[model samples]
Structures are given as structure tokens and as C-alpha cells.
Target: MSVRRPAAEVLQPKSFSFNEKNLLVVDTILSKYPKEKKASALLPLLDLAQRQNANWISTAAMKVISEILSLPLIKVLEVATFYTMFNLKPVGKNLLQVCTTTPCWLRGSDDIVSACKKKLGIDFGETTQDNKFTLLEVECLGACSNAPMVQINDYFYEDLNEDSMIKIIEDIQKGSKPKPGPQSKRTGSEPHNNRVKV
Candidate 1:
């Protein structure tokens, strides 16, 4: 499948540079690889660039990465475009990645998706007007045991139903950080109804 990148004239930034802190991080990452094998640092550098550039990888940022690693620009672009984790366009502060794999689906992930869309007033692959949330349907986030989950940025909110999902979004909008993990009474992937003794 072809990946769609934003038009350069439309959304690309003029340039990108790592800040002092990230530059130090770059040096540390590069140090882990042999000087001749600097390209191995490409993924981490791209990740750093994305984090520094508001969670999206711009063309200019990719170019900067290529120059830093002494790699061809195409190599950087190929890696960036191939990874779903790399966003080509700007995203909101909270990236809501709903897992809709078979496990999640079986556990009512559809309701979670609907709740997010209605609460955020945006469909999948779209961001809210306030730029606080972007909703996307992703494959399994490896939390099948906690099926029907949504990953908000770096945190996972599992064991969700429609009401809990809506409340989580509302909490974020109100500038409150909802505790991450199972929304239900169960704890940390433990069996429901205390089926297993810990």
C-alpha cells in the first residue's frame, strides 16, 4: 500500500535541527554503533527528530537526519515512510491509537472507537479542532490480555467500555491526567473476578 505524505509546499518546514539536549542524545546513540556503521542510529535519530518536531517527521527533518548520518536522503525517506509509527503530518498532543485487532474487536473495541469519534468530533486519521487529540485505528498494541484498549501517547488505557473511553478523553481535555491502565476494577492484566491467585 502506498503511504501518503503531506505535500512539501503545504506542510513541510523550512528546516529542522536537534536542540542541545537531543544533540547530546544523538552523540550517545551514535557512540553505541561503530563509526563506520553510523546508519544504524537512523531509527533513533528519526524518533528524536519526530519528538522534537511536534511528533511528526518533516522532509526537512529527514534531510537533517540524512546529513547527520552521512546517508542518502532517500534512505531516510524510505525508512520514515515505511514505518506507521512515523507520522508525516502534524498530530495533536494526545495521539489516540485504538487497537482494533481480532482480540480487541471481540472485546468491543468498536464501542471504544465510536466513543472517541463522538467525543473528539473527528473520524479516524483526523485531529480535533483544538489540536488536543488525533484519533487513529491501529493494529494490536500487544495488550490483547487487556483487549479493547486505546493508547494515548505513551500510556495504555485498557479494559475500556464506551463510557470509560469518553471519560478518559474528557479528562484529557479538561487538562487532567487520567491514570493509565485498566479502566475497570481489575488490575494490571490480572484475571477478572479474581480467577487466578497472584
Candidate 2:
């Protein structure tokens, strides 16, 4: 069965344009394609623009990208709205994505979600007042054997329990880089107490 993402409420910022550094990145992304095929760079350009403008893609930014690539405004908007990776609304500095698919659920992902709701005082799709963290429950993050895991920003932290999850959240709240991934003594997803291949 095909699944659809619940549409995000898109907000239009009054204006948006990349900074000098990002403009250079934008130029490079565009340069990869022939002038006639520059529109082919739409996905990367939108991604770069979203990162440049903060974590969300504004309508204005989409328009600018459309103009640069000479694609219709609708073309850019269609791509941006269709992909969940392109945040339509603003997200907190730290986006916490918990994996709650079958493997994770069986392995106690509910405990992870409970821990987040308890500590953050917010449910999924909500951000903190301080804009520090946004909590979201996502399907498989591809860490099945590491079963219960979460992705914060770009890092995957695995082998989580309630306390460890809370500690990670608290650490981020205090602006420190908590060590990421496999909080247990185990390395990666290797089974416990194993010194060598089975």
C-alpha cells in the first residue's frame, strides 16, 4: 500500500534570498546541469534554499528557485510540498525523529515516545517554546536491530532506553554534544558480549 504524508501547513515568508556563501553553493548546484536542463536541479536547489533560509522552505524561496531555473512556480511548489524532508513550516533547531515501526515498537519504542512526551511536555509535531527541540515519530530509520533508535538532526542514536533518551534530550537542552549512537557498551548493532563474528 502506498502511504501519503499528512500535508504540512505551508507558510509564505515575506521574502527570501540566499546569503553570499549559499549563493555560491547554489551556483555550483545549477552548474551541474545544462542551461536547458537547469530545472533538473530543482530538488537540490530547493534543499539548499531550505537550509539557507532555516529548516523550512518558504513560498518566496520556492519562487526564487523557480525563476532561476525558469520553471513554473507550480513546478517548484509541487516538489516542495510533495516531500516531507522539505519542512513547510519552521522546525526547532534540533529535530528528534523516533523510529516506531514494527521492529522498534516490539523493542520498546513506546518507552522512547513516552520519555520524550514526559520530558518535553509536548507530543509529536510540536516544538519547544525555546525552539530547542521538535519531537516527531517516524517510520523505520533503517536501524531495525538497533531497534529503538532516534535521529537528532543528522545523527542516529541507537539502543535507547527511557533514561538514556531523557539524558540525550537534557544534554541537547544544555547545548552540549552528547555522544551519539549505541548508548550501550555494544558497538554498532553487534550482539551483546560478543568479541568476534558468530
Candidate 3:
């Protein structure tokens, strides 16, 4: 992850060029802070833009954010480009952000990743031709308890195997949002715990 300069010091735009709602949202975010510290709301403002655009933030949107917050273009770019959550390119309707950090990798994230590649027919960072899904491998999502986990759109699936993983993908493809939690019934550690259970 890239180091973030505190939102306090960054420059912001004075006026936004997006939409009334977004401008309203930006206004709300700005209002939460003292009048002199509007720059502190950059993250939420950009997040609102990303959510409105489905999954990614566009360069134009960044420009609008810059203008709205009265920040320099490069400063806004610094925040937008540095975060993996901010997508410069188009992503699928459903984005699968797989956790490939060490714990996830050691457990079975690779298996889940492979299943996604086979089912979607697109490698990581690539979206399916049908525009239904995109696969992305990301670092620790702070879901280590559910080590082998994947975040689809805004939901998380943990303790996954090949079959369960496929089932979850199929569910998403069918427009069903699978409930977030462990795939297996076994209470946590039995699956990921490295210590002997004796």
C-alpha cells in the first residue's frame, strides 16, 4: 500500500463538475469538518464518486474532485492513483477483490483465485468478456480470520474451497448476493489454525 499524506494538508477544489447529488455529498463530507479544513473530506468525496460509477473512479471525476476541493490535480491524483481501491480502468459489474496476503495464500486463496480464473476465463486484473465479473488480487483485507477470502463488489466470502468458491461465483453471476461469512460450518480455527488440535 502507498503511504497517504493526511487529508488535512492536501489541496482541494473549490467547485465540483459532477452532479448535484455528488456535490451535495461532497458538501456534507466537507461540512463534517471545520470550515477551514475542507480538504479532510477527500477520501469520502472520492468514494462517493466511485460508488456512483459502479466500481472505478474516472480521471474526469478526479478532475471534478480537484476542482470541487480546490486541490491541485497532482494531489488528487496522488490519492486516487495510489489506492488500489480506486480503479483508473473500467471494471466488471461485479469486482472480485481476492485477498492474497500471506495468511490467505497459506490457507487456500490460490485455489479460490484459480477457480475464478477458470470460471471467468480472465486472469487477475482482467474482467470477463460478458462484463459480469473482474478478478483482482489484493493484499490483506484485514479478514485474516477468514484467511482464504474474497470480496465481491462490497461483500466478503471466507474459508472457501474450489466447489464453494465456484458456487459463490455462480450465485453472483445469477445476480444473487451470497450472504457474507464462513463457507464451512466448522468454527474458525479448525480450518486455518496451524497448531495441532490435540
- Which prediction has the highest TM-score against the true structure? 1
After superposition, the stretches of candidate 2 with alpha carbons farther than 4 Å from their true spots are 1-11, 195-198
* lDDT of model number 2: 0.85
lDDT of 1 by residue, 8-33 (tens): 53467798889999999999999999
Enumerate clash totals for all models, in the order shown. 0, 0, 11
Error of 2 at 23 (Å): 0.6
Mind giving the per-residue lDDT tens digits that candidate 3 earns over 44-149? 8888888887666667778878777789978998998788788666678888888889999999888988998888787876667777887788999888887799
Superposition TM-score, candidate 2 onto the true structure: 0.89
lDDT of 3: 0.78
Ranked by TM-score, the better of candidates 1 and 3 is 1
Q: lDDT by residue for model 2 over 19-131, one digit each (tens)?
A: 99988998899889998889899999988987787677888898889888998999998999888678877888888999999999998999999999889887888877777
TM-score, each model?
0.93, 0.89, 0.83
RMSD of each: 3.6, 4.7, 7.5
Error of 1 at 196 (Å): 3.3
Decoy 3 TM-score against native? 0.83
Ranking by TM-score, best first? 1, 2, 3
